[model samples]
Target: MHLIITDAWLARSRAIHLSGTRLLLVGVLASVFLMLMTVSVYHWLVVAGAGEGGGRLGRFVLNDEMAQRERFMRENLDAMARKVGEMQARLLQLDSLGERVSGLAGVSAIKAPPPAGQGGALIASRSLTVQELDALLRELNIAAEQRSDWMTMVESRLLDEKIRKSMVPTQLPTATGVLGSPFGWRIDPLTGRSALHTGMDFQAAQGEAIVAAAGGVVVTQEYHAEYGQMLEIDHGNGLVSRYAHASRVWVKKGDLVRRGQKIAEVGTTGRSTGPHLHFEVLVQGVPQNPEKFLVAGRDLPNTRSVATKSP
Candidate 1:
């Protein structure tokens, strides 16, 4: 390479010759200077796009990209907000269902742990961050799991209670009868004196089938001097039923009997005045009004009514 330098004050033009190492050094320096100029231009363009100097092409590209990013963020946030709203609505529905179940099951009161109280001044709302969304999702998941467990427990308890109630003695003892003598104070037919009637008398003809009111085991099936051929069923939970003054007994002691099963025939045996069934319900060792059980049975739409039949 050859280089020439000239100046107005110089007496004559100066010439310099470069070769090998010197030429290589000058080429490296020129390369470095060009690199520095390129870096400076790039930095200036970046600053113009980011700052108030928005006159360059870089500013337009950057604005378009930023607008797209903002739209994407807003759309995502709106979608998440809709999902959160749906979850909240579901939670409200679960609460209402829980309350109804509790009332029907006679749970008295459902006890839930009190939520921790929080107090804060209302502030300007902002977009939710990922961390906030994660926290909300975790809370909703925990609540849903808790509600599911509660519903399962309520269903189990309600089922058990329904089954147990069905086993209790609360049905008419005969399918064909009329109330002859009600429970409570009545003049004795034999003695002709005021006496406390321990049971209700169902007036029916002889040879009429008598059925068990509820499911139980026959605890006693024997003849009594005052009760005639009497039968007693031991329903569980300290409840029992006695069918007295029967013409004949069909079930034996220790025999399991289901509700509405034919157990005996109606007759006036022992100290009765006419053919009737003396039905009694006992709780523990005390006698309860048998009519109450029959009335309760009547409230059920499926209860079988007593009808007159031809012998």
Candidate 2:
């Protein structure tokens, strides 16, 4: 090696020179380093998973890791956006399912039923975590239970309506019948004195077919001295209607019969009188006005009778 004092400066800063094989070796080494730097810049721009773009080698050296980090951050943001979309879809599905359950339960509105756990509606509305979702499920279960109870009530009401409609007589026991004696006070039949008639009497031709007033189980069928042949039916709901002065009994005890079913034949069997049926309405063993109930269908006119009839 050689050194030449070309400028008056520090010794370390003095000019140096090389020649022959040494100078040629330095030139070759410098060429190889430039080639390696060019290849590295191309690899970083195209083959390092970073998008290819035209940039200077100097810029590539300063932003090597930065390119990879930018791509990673972009992917993370896309994943986050997808997650948000999926969450919104799940929320919409939950809302649709809730509306269906409400309709099945016959509720016009969808509101979470109150439950013991958690504070109140505030907790459900603000519910976001797993524990909050569990609380919401509990509230929904409570609402379903209440709907079950309400359905039971509706069934009971429906049953009562059916029973009432059945118990109300659809027609008079006799076809060509007239109200001979109404329910309540009147004169005695054999005693010839004032008495309480507990039933309404329908006068008709002897040997006429008499039908049951309602659908129920036949409770009593027997021959009697004062009422002749008597038939009684016990409808459910604390109701029992009686038919007296029958010539023949068609239904025996414990026999089920529908309304308007033939139950007896009307005739003068015991007491001296024309054929008549003594119809009574006893609710919980207490006598009620039979005429009021009978007029619903029979439209029986008001009649005054100085007589006491049996049921």
Candidate 3:
């Protein structure tokens, strides 16, 4: 490559020569300097624009994205809160039900021990995190399950108690009868001697209805020399009741009978002077006072000997 220089004031011209390698080096340097100028102008324009509209535009976009995330999080938290509230309401209902069941079962309500005392000055209350809310829900669920199990056990106990009470002899044997000879030591009408009467005598007309005192299975339905045409009912728990001196038997052995059900007709079929019904309540084959079971609203004394047996 060649370049020409002219000096106008001196009116002189000169010629210079360059090699190909030097020309290539000059081209590279010129290109590099243009690139440097371009980069400097770009940096100046960016820095100046940052204080104007460009900075606000960038921040607005970032803020909008953050708001979307916050809204999503709030929706999720609200849903969880509603669920927790519902669970708490259900737990309260369960507590109330437990109290009612305890009353029905005739048992005192079992209460949890009081919590340890804790108090502090109101400083600040912060929103719960997701982890905390989840933990609370789990605790509520566990409490509900425990309450359900407790209610089931209470129901079972109540059922058992109801069935047990049904087996107790609380009903009267005869609806229309007058009390005659009481259950204790008395003069034997036939022997004319002092003897223990194991049962109470109910004076009634012949063919009067004689009902069972309790619900049980008939265990004995046959004739005895002393207690003729007798019927015995086993009222569970080693308790039994005997209806003796009946004219006619309406139930047989192994027959299930309900309380107050007619099982015989009163008569003087046994060694009795007149038409009467002999009612006896025996505990494990030993005689107990029939008044102790038949008489209402009174707690009678246990005056009869425990070793005494019905002859």
Clashes of each: 1, 0, 0
* Per-residue lDDT over 26-49 for candidate 3, one digit per residue giving the tens place of the 0 to 100 score: 999999999999877555444444
**Per-residue lDDT of candidate 2, residues 1-311 (tens digit):** 78766544643456577878888999899999999998986776655634535435435665877888877766765565555557546644655675665464444434444447754455333214445445555755565565556556555665766666777654566665567888788888878899898888887777788887778988888888877788878888888888888878888999999877888887777774676777787888998887666656543222122223333
The residue pairs that clash in candidate 1, if any, are 175-306
Model 2: worst 10 consecutive residues (lDDT sum) = 299-308
Indicate the residue-level lDDT of 135 in model 2.
Answer: 59
Q: How much lDDT does candidate 2 score?
A: 0.70
- Which digits, one per residue and each the tens of the lDDT, describe model 1 over residues 184-265? 9999998999999998888888989988988899999998999999999998889999999999899999999988889999
Name the 10 consecutive residues with the lowest summed lDDT in model 3.
297-306
Number of the candidate with higher TM-score, 1 or 3: 3
Error of 3 at 14 (Å): 84
lDDT of 1 at 140: 88
Candidate whose lDDT is highest: 1
